[model samples]
Target: MTDLLHDARVSRGQFLRMMGGLAAAAFATACSTRPQTSTPSGGGQATTELKFIGVSDQKAPMDQLVAAYQKAKPSVRITASYAPTDQVQTSVRTQLGAGNAPDLHVVYPGSGSAMSMSQIAEAGLLADLSAQAWTRSIPEGFKPAFQLDGKTYIHSAGSSVIGAVYNKKAFEQAGVEAPPTTWSEFLSVCDRLKKAGLVPIALGAQTPWVTQLITYALVPSTVYAKDPTFDDKQLAGQTSFAQSGWREAMEMYLELQKRGFFNDNPNGTTFEQQTSMVATGKAAMAVQVSAVLPDFRKAASSPDDLSMFPLPGAGDAASVWIPAGVVVGLGAAAKGANVEEAKAFIDFLGKQENINAWAKAIAAIPLVQDASSTIDPAVESFLPFTKDRAVPFMDQRWPNAEVQPVHFAVIQELLAGESTIDEALRKMDEAYQK
Candidate 1:
């Protein structure tokens, strides 16, 4: 599953579109702390101050990590800054390019995304973490995302899967006996939900990024599982989106729309509205990232109201594939002022207790090999797929940064009846050429 590497170039225009034309200041303000001098663990050290950045949605758990680290080693002061996920990526890229990156920052595990580990490592911006003790325990399959040219840089505590988060009570009310394990059954279930006066699927395409979730969820079984080399071929110019399995995966998306399984005006719905629909039982299901499970639970009257299942893209139940990856992890900036101290904090974050705590706080599957951490029960049903039946998010491996924007735009247009699947795929292929 980790055989092919994707292009990780992040363009300025891509960052701008990701923020929906929002100004840099529209992102959360950077949280800083007063500089203090104190000795840190790991023997010889000086009173050091560290600047850090992280994903805002996971701020709760990250705050716990900061507090824990400071408590254990009072000599080091960290000014931790967090932004919305996309903003974090953009900010890090912009800041890193300006030669003023944080001491430590969030990075995607592998060769995907604008702020992926490989991108930073390739730029010679990440401190090597290959010799760290915690790294020895990580399974081989999980190593590639954090490594570049056989050297490790990122210290990710866990991984995440993308799947459909469904309202349990709504399913029972709709007379849906079980989660579907095949595409046909999935459509049948949606029909039943609609018959029972429920929205089959709530899609908020107004948040353009949300438009890619359905495609990502289905491609694991449709494209990667069929040929793990599909991405490699794409990078080598041996294949095109219009001529590959992407057509089938996307046709499934059109099938849902054609069958009226999606909520009316998906093009007008915001992500918040989409989550609210499932939380309030207005919709039976939603395709979403596992990291946002807590958000879904918080908006619900009962936290257990939601559970996730692998998207049934395969025709039958025989070893279905899931979209999964090392969602986000930490990497020490190579040219920061407090390199040693930052590396120390990163090491502390790799401890068994910290890894488990971080994983639990964010509802992720622990990447540490011997850690006792377990995934959330809501996501447990899809665990089997993660072992060997999972594929990394396809967009992460795209040849050009512009490919994602093309993906978002084409999907939005398709959802709005402004484009067709063939046209969308052709546009993606053209983006790859650029």
Candidate 2:
């Protein structure tokens, strides 16, 4: 039967034999049709096939790269599974409960995601992938976000900046001859743009992550820079999501929202759709990250139409490094059948060439030290600001998970007129109380 499965003529027939016991109609046979005795690609004997599970947001490049890998090794079969970023853990948890899960998926180290994986890791449901060469590429400051007791669980090729991207031309048009380097000047510029018949700022609260971007911009201004001992205080609970200057920040966010700056129905817009608002000049700027710039570049009539400036709260460039955000999460089911092969796939991914390709494809900065290799040219103009002073995105570094979500909820409530600034602050404080 194994030999027959390897035979081209009997491939379909063998699939039926293997899957018939699991289901009826054999139509699902095609789903499991790969030969069990297949040789590994790029080797003498195939080891195992890796099954990947994660968000489909980056699927295009993954597909292209995987196809190239397959061309180089016809024997290995690499299966990629995609789900919404929010759903990846839930899917894995469900499958774990059902005694079935992908060979490799996604997980984060703290709070919402890592908590779920921590149970499995404690139960030994995950495999140790720390030995992979890719682990070496992660920067020193960010290692904790992906690690559990010194073992790493996730790998992202690069990271994105969590700051503001403004239009150079918009400032010129609004009688603001120079980009403001102070928060007061920044708000004044927004008022100018709004008065000039342009939406002062663009936000996509409908997608939720947009709300996080707003918080990301505010984190540098409201927390990290203002508090002389911010990180220490935050870790000690002396400073919290609610106690900081966040109320002022939220008030300011609401003020902008009330002034009709963001898209009228931010909740109705997708990230891509909201990105268009900035790309086409519907809004003078967007509270976004480098992750969205690829979409912006693709949609822009002139890629030059978009450029970035760090949010003004840092007092100066030297003090403002905390606004960079990174996507950190673990790989999938450790005990799944594809562990060895999946590790192989990840190893191939960490190679500088592939990592560089992935970073440039998304217009993000490199996770590895050697960034000069392939930074996207259109976005490269923004790199100098990131150069000596780089910081992990605020959300990733935060110990308490609720802070980010509470931020989005409070902002939405503020926008809906459901809560006053005082109430929002109290709600925020209560949220941090947990």
Candidate 3:
């Protein structure tokens, strides 16, 4: 969901528009710890201090991870920092420029697009920890996010998938024996659920990222049909969000809305409320990530009742798998004799013990090459399908700076009936051309 987090009183719209801009500003504003007057890498075996930042929305597991990490590296002091999800990108960037960037930091990558943060890596603000043996353990297929152009720059601790989440009871109430697997079947299920007096698709229009998942579910099939490396291709500007299956995917979205599938005032709702709609049986299903499972569990009477399916598609091959994980890299601010020590902390994280702790902490699938790590059972059923062909969502990797906001606004407009599907695509085409 573009790494955005909910902040008190701030609407999702205001939050995301500020993401690219604020991400740069936040780090500068993040109180620099014990001011360092020099840019030279600090030296010494003296326990090098490392500042860390992670998202607060994910709990339970994170606290345990912090404890485990501290236990492993007694010599290094980590001042863990956390903020609303949307603020992280800005915060990290600010710290880097301020020379207070943590020795190791968390990054969420867009499938192919490289932005300001990657430039930091190019500038040597980040240390390359890939030479460590632990990284060799991260499995294949999941390495793209960390391995930029063959030379590994970042390391992924775990991985997750994007798909549709539904209430088992609601499906039964709608007389659906199982979740649909194809577009026609899905539409039929939506129709039955709607006829049964339930909102067919629970949408949090207020949190536009939630609405974007529908396209995420669809784009993979569209891209994979012509090329498996479609995501990488788009990242290179070989194709565009508006030119390919994206149009059909977006059309499917409008079709669902026009069919009266969404809950009332979807745009006014938040992701928390959208999950609640399915959890409480107010609606039939929602398009969400596997990471969303634990949250649904907390929101519902029985978390076990919530299940996932890769979004139904145009794929001749299989359903899609999209990455929803973090990228950890050594900091440019890391100087001194402890530079290697900071490198050691990152290496330590890749170890089976720390990697397992991080994955299980957040209920994440260890993307690292560890044979022992596993994902939640609900998400496990679909893992086999992810093995072959799948496309990352078009917007997740869209090259244009304006794509995210333009897509967000277009979806809202579609919901408001202010724009037709054709007009929406036309606008998208204009943005991509820019």
What C-alpha lDDT do the candidate models reach, one value each?
0.85, 0.67, 0.67
**What does each candidate score in C-alpha RMSD?**
11.6, 8.8, 10.4
Which residues of candidate 2, in runs, are more than 4 Å off? 1-47, 71-73, 87-89, 108-124, 168-172, 175-178, 228-232, 258-260, 265-270, 314-321, 328-332, 377-390, 398-403, 425-434
Among all candidates shown, the one with the greatest lDDT: 1
Clashes of each: 2, 9, 18
TM-score of each: 0.87, 0.80, 0.80
Best by TM-score: 1
**Candidate 1 TM-score versus the reference:** 0.87
RMSD of 3: 10.4
Span of ten consecutive residues with least summed lDDT in model 2: 109-118
* Candidate scoring better on TM-score of 1 and 3: 1
Name the lDDT of candidate 1: 0.85
Q: Please, what are the lDDT tens digits per residue for candidate 3 over residues 63-181? A: 66657767875556666777765677677777667776665566544332223224555656656666888767655654555555555556556666777788889999878997676
Cα RMSD for predicted model 2: 8.8
The C-alpha local distance difference test score for the whole of candidate 3 amounts to: 0.67
Cα lDDT tens digits for candidate 1, 1-434? 12222244556567558677465445433334444445565666665778888887668778998998888987787878888887887888999999989899988777656788887888999999878888888776666777788888999878888999999999999988889999889999999999999999999999987999999999888888888888789889888888887899899999999999999999999999999999999999999999889889999999787999988998988846898877678899999877888888888888888888888988988776354677699889987787788877776566446788889999999988998888899988888888
Query: TM-score-based ranking, best first?
Result: 1, 3, 2
